[model samples]
Target: MKIEAHDKQIQDIFSLGYFQIPRFQRPYSWERDEVENFWNDIINDVSENYFIGSMVVYQERKPYFGIVDGQQRLTTITLMLSAIRNSFLRLGEDNLAKGVHKFVEQPNIDNEAEFILDADTSFPYLQDHIQSFNGLKIDCDVGIEEQKLKNAFEIICARLEDEVPTSNSESGGQISMFPVDVPDPILKLKEIRDKVLSLKLVFIQLDNKSDAHLIFETLNARGRDLRTSDLVKNLLLSKIKEGNAKLDSAKESWNSLIRKFDDASESEIIDSFLLHFWISEYNYTTDKKLFSAISKYVSEDEKNANDLLKKLNHAAAIYCKLIDPGAHEWSREETDVRESLKALRLFKVKQQSSMTLALLRAYYEKRLTLRNLKACLRKLEYFHFVFNAITSQRSSGVIATTYSSHAISLTGAKGNDDIQAIISSLFNSLRTKLPQYEEFEVKFLELSYLSSKTKNKGIIKYCLSKQFGDKFGGIDINHDAMSIEHIISESTMKDGLSSDVVGSIGNLLLVDEKTNSEELMNLTVSEKIKKLEGKGYPLAKALVGEKFPESSGVQDRARSIAQHLYNSVQL
Candidate 1:
């Protein structure tokens, strides 16, 4: 590879024309505090110097180093230069203004030798600063917040006064500079600017004509964090280079999925889409770890991985379309639609579950048949609520309550085998219940299966509150104090207990913590049952009449409790 080295004069860097800064480059908007911090860093000598990194410029029909990593610094410098130029114009220093203007103007396409003004370049921030300056007036009432911008302008003016060389002419004539006095408020502006420009910064210049893509990957891999979307884009670029038709088709399909969400910027859509993919396909949870893995993998033989990525992209696109027809708009919402999709995808991948997709299909199909968009939207809202309840940091009790509320609406007086079975039951329930009850049904059903242990606890409480209350004397059903004590501890088991015996819901109880600790602590499930029997409340008889009556054996006892719990809560 060819190697070249030269110092990139601060005044000579070109703008990275028309490219939108990717949203994934930084989180949300930089708040005022961060902006103020940046300003403080510039004013203080903490960071004495800044370098605007080199970038690749598509000049003269060939790509060359334009500006790499220093875009932020370069943009800021251009803003300052523009401010200086405007200040000179305001002060009536026409000649000095021209000199300032020389640094801001764009270079001619054919004349590469022209000393184009850096301020005149088409950088967005530079343009905004210049426009702001031109709009300012001494007599105009500027807001307090705008005072910072005004101060920046005044500082630029002072710096101009300090930098422009004085001129004298022969033939008995002398030129005078602008007459603006150095304001005490802006006295330290020159010092701040000089200190900012004096700090040393290192830049490793790679040969522009070499495999720049590989260099870019290496640079990203070295120390910087690559966002999931960035990794996806890099993978896409690598796939395109591989010259595969299927990969190209998949890319186009993915693009179509993103284009559907026209409200979100491309990067926002892409990032959300990639997050969905990583969670679904690779079962990855953290975005950082996923990006790092993909980055490493793509940096290797990205071409060879094209087929797998294409398949994943295709699956992701279909999933996105199903969940978010509005595409980007749906993804951008604060609601956990992406996470919901991720959870759904994981269910499909890990458990062979298709309830989510089935529900979506049922919703749309039902809506189309009934010609009720409002109903569909309502269902969608309920789905959103249930999904959030499960995925959010909800307490197990709260989740169980929410799930029960939703499930009862669908299953009614009869329960089902699984969530999908409940879904069908729910639709039937919806047929009879009022429209408003639909959400309650969905939420109850969704949370019902979140955790078997949680469900069992809820079940035992429901059974005791309905059955043994008052009959069991002063036994207060404290749901909060209820614990799911294993009748036979798994730790003490020789041959593992069957679901009927120790693992069944019948084997569990909603006993108070004090009773559980004092009477049953360290006891095996069989021992605990024996102690409860001694207390004139045989475990089998306690739950026998409630639901499952076959509590004779250990397995039967477990099943009896679970059956009773399940039955008591069935709508």
Candidate 2:
């Protein structure tokens, strides 16, 4: 790529030509902290020609270029200039304000106002309101971007106000007048304005559009990472026209996907969705390399970009459901799928999600049967229970690779038989990775729930409900039933049992809140057995049949429970 690079002052760059940041570029996201840092940089190096950074742009029309990078700093510089101009206006420095106003905007041949740094993201809010010469316009919706521009202007105004000398000074809670002879505030403000204009940066001018794409990858690679979604959004929408139907529709679709994770950061939500969805369809990838992987897959091909966009749009809703299943309802016939989803979530088994996303997509597309999907979920739940929860094993990265491979296989296969084969392979692979029964039982025996064990809130209930769930008289096993009755209470512990043993899964039971509080609060072994009798729970019968000791009995019971839960797995 051919490049012409030169170190230029901020004032010199603005004088060369009108510049525009592509509309699809990330919005003016520099909030208070970033603005403050910019202000401090100027003030701290008040006397020096401070070197800010580099700016990259490509020629679009003659004398107009598209900003490839450094939009945040450019937008911020414009905001600061506008703020200084407004300050001059308020101080009745009309001539000085007009001089600054010329830099903010210039009159074109058509006699219309043209801002030196045209930004599509901030648009009318930046030009019409924050940088407007006449009056404030509250005509448009003030979204986050608009609000940020408004705030930045206010912040600069406040910072400028802080620099002016006050007539009175406070010492020891007493106010006194200051002697005359402080530097003129207007002159000080002008010094800041000039310092901003002189800020130095290396300017690299790309002669054509393709050069911008060639260099875009390395522009922000040196600094803190650019948000992956931001890069993806820019890549897709750069070639799209501002007011075109395709652009508007695509923008709305992207915005809808964004809204799905309204409560999450775009990086956390969309970035995560893209990576998992990619794993489901393509090969495995990490968050750091997701953008590069995507760019390679969709290289310079609009059709590929559009196809990926549609796939992303489809996967987005499903991705949100995978993260949270209960929020969306399932059909009556898919009750098993619903329960399996809840169980996987409760189990905190995220390694299963990529494969699960694939299975769900196939099922939804009607390419894979519902029965097969349920079987996959069941196998996944069982494997994770043994592998993650019961054995307390590390993820080891191989499990992710296995799931990712199966996830890739599930996509674009012939039919259910093909998908079922993939599912069967996934289970068989997972089975080989499981620990032996002796090892599994030993690890399971270590389970305790005194506080937040297994990264699950109701793990004790999860275990009890899974074991004696049918005995709950059809109550939802997932719920706590308003209470979990901890056997061997304080009195029982005072006798012999340690707290760890007392809180072990074997010593816990899920019962009605009222029953736990009324009949089973501080029961000894005999008392617990008596109260637990006639409860129609086989767990109760087993406990009653054994002569229970405080310490070793819990381990014995845990072993028995482990054997039952572990042996029941189809593997």
Worst 10 residues of 2 by lDDT: 167-176
lDDT (Cα, tens digit) per residue for candidate 1, span 120-219: 1223332344533343333443332234344554554454445542222122222233245633312233344344344344444445423444544555
Cand. 2 TM to true fold: 0.81
Q: For residues 261-378, what per-residue lDDT tens digits would candidate 2 score against the true structure? A: 7645446667778888888898998878888888887776667777787788898888877887777878867877876787787777778778989989988898888887787787
Q: Give per-model TM-scores.
A: 0.42, 0.81
lDDT score at residue 257, model 1, on the 0-100 scale: 47
- Model 2, residue 18: what's the lDDT? 89
Cα RMSD to native, each candidate? 17.0, 5.0
lDDT of 2 at 131: 71
In order of listing, the candidates' clash counts read: 40, 0
Residue 556, model 1: Cα distance from true site in angstroms:
31
Flag regions of model 2 displaced more than 4 Å.
Answer: 15-18, 28-35, 82-108, 114-118, 121-184, 227-231, 234-256, 284-293, 300-302, 342-349, 451-458, 468-471, 475-483, 490-497, 511-552
With candidate 1 superimposed using the best TM-score fit, by how many Å does residue 525's alpha carbon deviate from the native? 48
Could you give me the TM-score of model 1 versus the true structure? 0.42
